[model samples]
Target: MINLFRSYNPLNILWLAVLVIALRIGYIIGAPDKLEFVFVESFARLLVPVSYEYALTPFLNVLLAGALVFAQALLLNKLVNQFNLLGKPSFLPALMYVTISALFTPFLILSAPLICNFLVIWMLYKLFSLYKGDDIKSSGYDLGMIVAIGSLIYLPFIYMFLAVWIALIIFRPFNWREWIAVILGYATIFFFLAVLYYLNDRFHTFYKIWLPLGTQFPNHISINNYTYVLLAPVVFILVLSVFKLQQGFFKSYVHIRKAFQLLLIMFIIAGLSFYVKRQFQLNHFLLCVVPVAITFAYYFLYTTSKWFYESLYLLLLAGIIYFQFNTF
Candidate 1:
């Protein structure tokens, strides 16, 4: 399977579809009767002024989510190849993304963080272009708005605003205007939201959106031990990818190095920002899959041991399918 995706072939998409179904089939068969889809965050509910939670049959829920994951994987793969991030094109990123997105049951269904991934990919495309463009103030502003939009879907997504500044620092010189443009961009969305609040006579509740920012980090998070077991392969691959990157970090082109650095920061911010949501769940980490899949692609592309990498990827697939059928 790894060998099949190691090259960029259009036919591989058929295999990717099969992979998506196979990974999700077990859960779909045993899924709960009622699946709740949270289309937006609570504050966003007020802003959109519609039903945020909708109940759907298990099969329909998984099917829609599967379609979304497939589309996002292709989009991310396009972005990776566009920038020559992996030195050459391959379907590995898409394959890895489909695999990673199914790592947890919650991720296999429709949720706010899963929906926000499209914005994450859009941000990456604009973020990577910063290196080539002469003036990126527009890009900064767009990114700020993008992050704000994503925050509307998932509140923790607000932290991605930091990545806009980090990208400016890595890809461009110190320009205060570019730095400040992001803030104005972020506020642009909220300004309208504030207006809506005032018109609705709910201006008093507008301040509650930022209250989560002040919440203290929990001393400990109670997670099932099996969740760690499920993450074992993910941890192994990330550690290997880090060492593999470190080995050739300076050897890569300047733009590529900075791009990877920015991605690493984005991953950290996305992963840690979940603490801000009082009712966070594993699905929130779907925001990290784009960067993590790219990192996995890097290691798989460069690693010389064909048999070892092949077996490692197989182990990951087997684990995902196995866990889906039998719960810990």
Candidate 2:
């Protein structure tokens, strides 16, 4: 299965869909009678209202989630390929994305982070374009607005506001104007939102939108023991990816080096920002999956030993399935 996605082939898309369904099969079978779909304080609902009621059967819910995630995986794959982030065209990024997205059962369903991922990809596109363009102000403004929109979907997404500054540091020289542009762009969104509230005589509630940003760092989180087993493979892959990156660190092109640095910042920010949510949920970690998938792709693409890499990939798939059935 790993070898099949090592190259770019149109037919591989079919296999990708198959792999998505195969990974979700266990969860589909064991899903609860009434699967809840919650969109906590999502401003996106104003645009597209999601039905919170579990009117559909568990199987159908899982199926629908699987389909949505599968499509996201494909789009994510296309984004990576479009930017040539993997150094060469291949299906590895998509495969890794789908696999990592399923590592946690909570990630299998439609969630805010999953929706915010589309914005993340859009942000990356604008960030990467910085290397080739001289228009820092416009790009910074666009990225700020993108992050602002994402925050409306998932409040923790506001943390991605840091990535814009980090990307500017990685891709451009010091310029205070560009930095200010980001702030201006972010405020632009809320300025309009505040106006809407004022017109509706609900301006008093406008301040409540920032409440999630004030959540304290968590002291404790109860997680199943099985989740630790699930983390083992991911940790191993990340360790291997770090070592691999170190080996070729200085030798890679300047743009590639900066891109990896930007991705690292994204991963760290996304992971830590989960604390911003008052209630800790596993699905919140979906924000980390995008960069982690790219990191996994780096390891899988560069590792020389076919037998070892393939075995590791299988181990990851097995871990996800086993834990899904064993735990939930």
| Maximum-TM-score candidate | 1
Q: What are the per-model C-alpha RMSD values against the true structure?
A: 1.1, 2.0
- Model 1 scores worst on lDDT over the 10 consecutive residues at 47-56
Q: Cα lDDT for residue 144, model 2?
A: 86
lDDT of 2 by residue, 1-328 (tens): 7778988998999999999999998888787777766554553344345566566778877787778778877887887888777788889888998899899888887677877887888888889889878868988888889988888778888989998998888899989999999999999987887887787677787888887777888888989888888899889989999999888888888988899899999999999998877678899888888888888888898899999999999998999988778884
For model 1, what is the error of residue 128's alpha carbon versus the real structure, in angstroms, after optimal superposition?
A: 0.5
TM-score of each predicted structure versus truth = 0.98, 0.94
Per candidate, the number of residue pairs that clash is 0, 0
Cα deviation of 221, candidate 1, in Å:
1.0
Model 1, residue 56: C-alpha shift (Å): 2.3
Q: Over the full model, what C-alpha lDDT does candidate 2 score relative to the true structure? A: 0.84
For candidate 1, the per-residue lDDT at 308 reads 95
